[model samples]
Target: MKGLGPQIPTKAPPKQSPHFRLYARKYAKSNAWTLKVKNPEHSHDSIENIMVHPAFRKFNEQETSQTAQMSESLLMPRKIWAQLCSQRESDRPVILQYIYNQIKKVKKDKVQGRRPIDALIDTFKEENFVWSSERDA
Candidate 1:
């Protein structure tokens, strides 16, 4: 008589270990932890686990939206300014007027109360390009 051989049970593998589930739940409850604490923002998220811990879900959404908007506002102007400032002297005059215009626009849009001349002076000084009439002897 063939005995009730190999008991067959229908069940899926446990999705997560009990220890991991507990740790995840605890991690999702802490808020003051920095992004570098165990889970950085750039860390890869697994499909089996939630991408963002519960504590950071709302904050992450707000931060993402604000960052996108800020990037849009600063992207083009910053690129143009950086490119112009990095060019050689002989290649700069053509873009000088464009850079000057962008500086004015940034000041106006940001309401920073800085004059274009002052900004140009600061940029030149920061780049170590301040002009002097002294000639090499």
Candidate 2:
């Protein structure tokens, strides 16, 4: 699902906007999901703006691998975005939001089912690190 571009506030009671709707229906027999369009007459000005939309924007395989590796190394999202942008000059520039979302997903995958603190503790143990905590009175 892509954004409908920037929105402009209107003082009028009724704001003019496209009424496009899509529905996903599950087949009763097969339990398969199928998409159905309610209205096809959607008004969109330009297709180029889709490149900036986070939902529609995508990273290539190389960029995806790089993002995963960098995320594992604990690199900041902004730095990762800059590195990706500098690596290539494509028609579609990398969106910072996309990078941030990707990094979040990567980190979540790394943590898997374990709690974040548990994962950190496991990492520390793997590295032979030590820490101690004291109760406050």
Candidate 3:
């Protein structure tokens, strides 16, 4: 009679790379957007395949990259946002509102201030430009 065999620990398989996961998620979202916009009759797999073609793949990559950069900028910490608002007056109100909204979503207190539109006018000075005689005529 054989003694009890040594126990072997079983572990789950390693996860997929982050790049592949990002690619797959972006591809799925883009495919859905395309289907909605064009009302196509293709299956999900077929649409996914088409969307992964070299041309569409490159386009998707660029779009995803740009979106990532934009989100990173938009999600900067409050201190960073304040610094940016101080440096870029034109962007202050929009940036402030963005930060406020982010805070508000998590039920945090927000600094009460003027609306984004008011900030825009204050930042840009809407009525101070002088028009040329020819253009006015």
**Residue 103 lDDT, candidate 3, scale 0-100:** 44
All candidates' lDDT scores?
Answer: 0.46, 0.80, 0.42
Full candidate order by TM-score, most accurate first: 2, 1, 3
The runs of at least 3 residues in candidate 1 whose Cα sits more than 4 Å from the true structure, single-residue gaps closed, are 1-111, 132-137
lDDT of 3 by residue, 36-62 (tens): 223233333345445434443231333
> What pairs collide in candidate 2?
none
Error of 1 at 126 (Å): 0.7
Cα-based TM-score, every candidate: 0.20, 0.60, 0.16
Best by TM-score: 2
- By lDDT, the best candidate is 2
| Deviating ranges (above 4 Å) for candidate 2 | 1-12, 15-40, 46-50, 53-56, 132-137
Error of 1 at 122 (Å): 0.4
User: Lowest lDDT 10-mer window, candidate 3?
Assistant: 17-26
lDDT of 1 by residue, 24-53 (tens): 323556554333234233334465644334
Q: Please provide, for model 2 over 5-70, each residue's C-alpha lDDT reduced to its tens digit, 9 standing for 90 to 100.
A: 876665656545657899998999999999988767775555656667655458988999999889
